[model samples]
Target: MTDKIVESEAPLTLVGGGWADRALLADLRRHAPGIVAADGGAGLVLASGEMPLAVIGDMDSLDDAARARIDPARLHRIAEQESTDFDKALRSVAAPLILGAGFMGARRDHELANFNALVRHPHRRCVLVGMDELVTLAPPDLTIDLHPGTRVSLFPMRALHGWSEGLHWPIDGLDFAPDARVGTSNVATGPVRLRFAAPGMLLILPRDALDPLVRTLLATPGAWPAP
Candidate 1:
């Protein structure tokens, strides 16, 4: 990773290549003005009529046409296979919150990599937006006001322990392992509270919960645990 950090005064949006929808980009940009694309995502950002602050990735998926459109100074090529474009952009950008679009819904592997990126860099607070779900790395401690019956699924990227209240299935006293047991399809009985004993928990909630989650992430005050 480069020593230079791309800091944003406001929340940032990461446009990826799994799937690009013009309307989705516009909506996300409304909240996150600073936009950064992940390789091929530059093409989608251009198609949406918005210029990205920078396009960061390995540069393999970036076609000549897309490269020609992006300012040379804004095009950052990491050219490393050990990490994906999503990883490159997330680690490079510094923002209070990051909302990622076009990173989910197309390929399962690509989506999974994006999730891996989220877990790998716990310091980056990013949420991946899909058609129907919003995935984010669960903070060390989180509290959200939600209506009863709202879906609050927790998927562990690594084995960890945590406690929760106001959920149909309490996460308390549960041994969570990535490959062994996952907490999915849990329902929120009311306003929910979560205290993660460690990092590596992934929080999946309904798409409509995106805005509230973003606000919660910003209002909460604490630095992420070291990876």
Candidate 2:
């Protein structure tokens, strides 16, 4: 069973120790009001003049001053060294949707691990927000309204096959795999719809599409069962 550290009916914002600025945090808060930090992310949250509802991680990156500022009750430490702090925080949050910031930029490996976490925790409905784009693990099925000539990219963490509509090229019979076939730089002709046979497909879209994507994900009936 998953141990939930923070549960919310509304969309929640998750902060990490990566590259997140005040402007980005403020924009994310408009959609996801509640904030939670991952390890040293507590410092970034505090610097924004906002208190995190809970701080979840291995507690190594959290500094003395930031630790002293946060209430002891809100600090959650997971000693396991295998998973990244992004994985820890994503698993601990139980919300309709999660808007993640600070998980991208700075380190290339960390950004890649963020994508790995999205595929690892397929059941978690979360989106990682970057400066120019948004990334999320595509559910079994997803539909979103997009303007003509909008960019839509699909990357597979595991080998999977899927179908698409309103794309410049159809994906009905195409094979997708990380080592071999990957979908990127696809343009949407209009409103786009997609369905995959399994989990592990990551969807990348422009940063401006965050609101619509969140609405579509939440309104979708069911999610892929926890692996």
lDDT of each: 0.89, 0.94
Model 1 accuracy (lDDT, Cα): 0.89
Q: lDDT per residue, candidate 2, 1-227, as tens digits?
A: 65799999999999999988999999999989999999999999999999999999999999999999999999999999999999999998899999999998779999999899999999999999999899999999999999999899999999999999999988999999999999999999999999999999999999999888988998987799998
Residues 117-172 of candidate 1 have per-residue lDDT tens digits of 99899988898998888999999888888889899999999999899989999989
In candidate 2, clashing pairs total 0
* TM agreement with the true structure for every prediction: 0.96, 0.97
Best by TM-score: 2
Worst 10 residues of 1 by lDDT: 1-10
Q: When superposed on Cα atoms, how far off is each prediction in RMSD?
A: 1.5, 1.1
Model 2 lowest lDDT segment of ten: 1-10
